[model samples]
Target: MSFSLTTDARETFIFAAKNVFRDYETTPPAPEPITGNTWDNVTGNEVKEAALALIRDGKDPAKDKSIQELLLRWQLSQSGIFPVLAAENENQTLINEFNAAVKGLEALTPAAEEDAQILANAASRLTIPNLGDSYSGSPRDAMLHAGARVADARLSKYAEAAGTLLYLRGIQVQGEHMTPNWFALAPLTFKDAHRHSLRSAGTASPWTLAHARINIEPAANIEEIQERINAYTTGKRAIERQVEAALPQWQNLPRDAYQDAITRAVNGETMRDARGGIVTWAN
Candidate 1:
């Protein structure tokens, strides 16, 4: 069956898409204003006040080299401007200190490497084959598609493992019987006669006469059984690869997408059998 999203589900997808876009566009807060004492225990405010004092004294603060350096350093710290330092130690000034603080703050900022791709994918409105036409052209379809795809892939793996366990006991036949012997029947006999005679023959047959019953009990050690199942499913390295590929998209999903995926998984709505057929759970 094709995947289709309901009206509410579509709205959820749009909301998540908008969030992804907003996160991408949102600028990180400017590095917290560097706070510390300047040269000789002078604070940023003190440096600013001293520069103002020079101006009040009918002197150019810019012409006073010491005052100029302090004022420049104070300005750099407050303006969020990273100062570049010269190679000579003799010229080492507040600019070097400010630059160091800036570098330190930069190191603390987390990289936004995944932002662009996440935003583009959320906005692309891409479609997946399973979701079908119902989700086409919908806002944030790309993220929905990604979530559904990953959920389906996980379900398929689970179904395969479960189906294997189901088949381990072998197929059960309700009634074993042989085909009608057309040659042995009278030439004018009707088809009904042939069938009746075959039934009689089957009944008299030794193989059919015997009744065999084989009762299989659940594993004595449930924990061991669970461990084995986990070994068969979660322990597979390939499953990890699938998880890694889908995780970024999954992480970017909105709450609705997360809920939808979990609901489908628990309800077996996303499971596929060994033959790649959908497996619906009983209500």
Candidate 2:
């Protein structure tokens, strides 16, 4: 059946679709998978024995402190709270001591990297059957697939809205699907519309023309349309008011402080507190 939409509806749908695209593009990428063999070997009886031996050896207090710090840093790294880049130099002393201890332990067995790889391979081979079968793949893979499905569903809604808007504009639209799946649109004549009509009289009508092919480009120009809409809605006076509201006490600051504050604000390192006081740093 043929259908149509009003101009306001078309604009609103286009605006919403653009927002969806913007959000999708700005979403953060997934985190990297965990790595390294220390996590796997740290719990072994041999590792515990070696750690105890080091403690009982009556090592210098400074050496013992470095060993303790190294262990703490290793545990923190395993938990994903990696050492800060700026603190690397400060950690070098502890890292050297940790490496010495690790080297001593390695002399009695395979290298830590090699041992970790062996353990990883062994775990992979011990996979359970029928686990996550309902998802058609591993749990992590299934989760990614589900996310893609949701994105596709959202895009489909935008496509439908675009098609409706085009139909209202008297464009011939063809195809049942839209972008990220398939593109369908073709020109149509009155006779073609009539032939595909659902009307009881089987005659050509304005409603049948709603099935006309529509170009996808207009809907894709959402950014340009949004800019135009914003320009119309946000007048110069409104912008001035917003600026005044955002920095109400800008005129009261000393000249030097004002320039510094402006620089910090531009760099996103400063902001106004609840009481309109300037906060120069973040915790």
Candidate 3:
């Protein structure tokens, strides 16, 4: 079966595309003021307020539309631990500090505005792919799936290590169980994500491509997704080695987590359905 991403899902795909291309944009000498709707035009202080409100009084999607939308964009943007994780070499102390800072209410707000702007800039530079096209088990579709796996692997490794995954989970309110979507450019409405590869065959920088290759080596060949995943023993083993490697020494600062699910999914023990939901295999 094939599926085309919904509007929200397409935005999420674009988010991943931006994630890989955020560094290449040109901006004004002075940061331009953010412009948009009432929900969209909120300031840094307001974002912090919304964050607190989200933690203190979880916004209902219906009643608290404004703050909820703001919070959604912030979290969905490159805020919190994302910038750190998305850094070239993931850091340890930064991970430790981010795990610590999120507990307090003040430190994260200033960065929130900047990160949202970064996403804005990326969106301008990004040539959004044909997300409207249907995705089946084609090579392009596989590239998209493998890209999401790379995303999950990258996230699960560090986020799980720093204890931030479940820590963030504990803060969920209104019974909304957050998934990889909440963190990465992973799509929410659709059960999966789109990342750098889907944006363009050759647009991702060598660094980003190298990062993906380190975890899933065969993934370097976007066409490899067409083969049975189980046959990619080298890719699976590459992921294992990456999983077991020692943390890189502390970098100056940046960010901070997911793994088994991806390995199993990659090895064909589990898989995502057409809509991006998880589908387990009993055999």
TM-score of every model versus the real structure: 0.16, 0.21, 0.19
Off by over 4 Å in 3: 1-100, 128-181, 184-187, 191-283
Residue-level lDDT of model 1, residues 40-151, one tens digit each, is 3335877778878989999887789988778666666555433222222212333333233223322222222222223234334442323333454545565555554443
For TM-score, the strongest prediction is 2
Rank the models by TM-score, top first.
2, 3, 1
Task: Predict model 2's lDDT versus the native.
Answer: 0.36
Comparison by TM-score, 2 against 3, better one: 2
TM-score of 1: 0.16
lDDT of each: 0.34, 0.36, 0.33
Candidate 1: worst 10 consecutive residues by lDDT?
A: 206-215
Residue 30 lDDT, candidate 2, scale 0-100: 28
RMSD values for the candidates in order, in angstroms, are 27.9, 28.0, 25.0
Tell me the tens digit of each residue's lDDT in model 2 across 1-283: 1234444544554454344335334321222332342232132344445567776787543467655655665565556543353244334433333333222322312222232233233234323222222456677656544443343343443334433334444443222121211111112222232234321222212111221221122122323333432342343234334334556675776777654553444344766743677665321
Ranking by lDDT: 2, 1, 3
lDDT digits (tens) for residues 1-283 of candidate 3: 0222234433333233233223223221221232331223335677777667666765543456776676667665535444544441223323323333322212222332343333333333333333233446657545654444444343333222212222333322121222222222211111121233222221212123223322212121112222322233344345434433322321321232224433343344654433455556332
The runs of at least 3 residues in candidate 1 whose Cα sits more than 4 Å from the true structure, single-residue gaps closed, are 1-129, 132-136, 171-283
Off by over 4 Å in 2: 1-136, 174-283
User: Ten residues in a row with the worst lDDT in model 2?
Assistant: 176-185
Which candidate do you rate higher for TM-score, 1 or 2?
2
Clash pairs, candidate 3, are: 84-254, 84-255, 155-257, 155-258, 156-257, 156-258, 157-258, 158-257, 159-257, 160-257
